[model samples]
Target: MSEQALTLKQSGVRWLWVAIVIFFADIGIKLWVMDSMGYGWANRIEVLPFFNLLYVHNYGAAFSFLSDQAGWQRWLFTGIAFGVTALLIYWMSRLPAKEKWNNIAYAMIIGGAVGNVFDRVVHGFVVDYLDFFWGSYHWPAFNLADSAICIGAIMIILDGFRSKKLRTSN
Candidate 1:
């Protein structure tokens, strides 16, 4: 086997392992939360004044927007998730194996997307818990999957900024 081919194989194996671990962890947490807490049930084990453990179901995109649609949104979001996940997987595999943070960002996004996709496919909605409030204002409830996606987005942005700074410095 050529050296390039061997490197590619090793990278693919590493990415696969990373992806699997992320995917399974996301799914496993969701499953446990669902089974233990039951759907739309909030335990409210108050850890702070502004936080609560409240489970909510989201039938549409962020903030429950389009949740009341006559119906079509389910399949639309599902298709979008699948397409984006496919692209992320391809990009992740093509990245240099030594770019650890970039690889981490891609894997996180892939895992998060897969987790929400599973929910959309099975229940036609995503289950959200983790809630916060401030005075009269409240933030939308979200789950582990959404958290992962947000973290991934932050990491990607930071990575880009760091790379740009390095280029400019040189």
Candidate 2:
């Protein structure tokens, strides 16, 4: 194999640690929330004017898509998360070390995916606790895993724009 390919192979494995860390942190926080607050809105703690620590269980995809359906969504979402995690691992493995933003993005996605997958398998749903609201309007409750995934996605988009700018400048 070429030197560049070999270097990528060696260095790419190191980036997986970022995913592992995110997974552990997500799980740990979820456990803490579950233990401290139990389930439902009665235990919600208001921390700020626009923020609260509330527990919710998501049985479907983002924003509770298909949440009103029958029980099939749990397995469906779990399967999708597993598939996405595998794809992220493959993509991360192929990326060169110099692609720092891409590496971080993939790692965060992988970690978050695995974390939510664990919850689906063990609890039949994902536990969400972070709550943000503006007066009576509220954003959907989400957890650390969701936050990591969002951050990763944003980083990927920003990196794409940066890459495009660099290409045009050159």
State each model's C-alpha RMSD to the native.
2.4, 2.5
Give the clashing residue pairs of candidate 1, or none: none
Candidate models: Cα lDDT each: 0.77, 0.88
Error of 1 at 117 (Å): 0.3
What digit string (tens of lDDT, one per residue) describes model 2 on residues 32-109?
Answer: 988888678788999999999988899887898888888798899888988988888878777766677888898998
- The residue ranges of model 1 lying beyond 4 angstroms of the native Cα positions read 1-5, 38-43
- Could you tell me which 10 consecutive residues in candidate 2 have the lowest summed lDDT? 5-14
Q: At residue 39, give the lDDT of candidate 2.
A: 78
Backbone clash pairs in model 2 (N, Cα, C under 3 Å; residues 3+ apart or in different chains), count: 0
Clashing pairs in 2: none
Question: In order, how many clashes per candidate?
Answer: 0, 0
lDDT of 2 at 94: 75
- TM-score of every model? 0.86, 0.92
lDDT of model number 2: 0.88
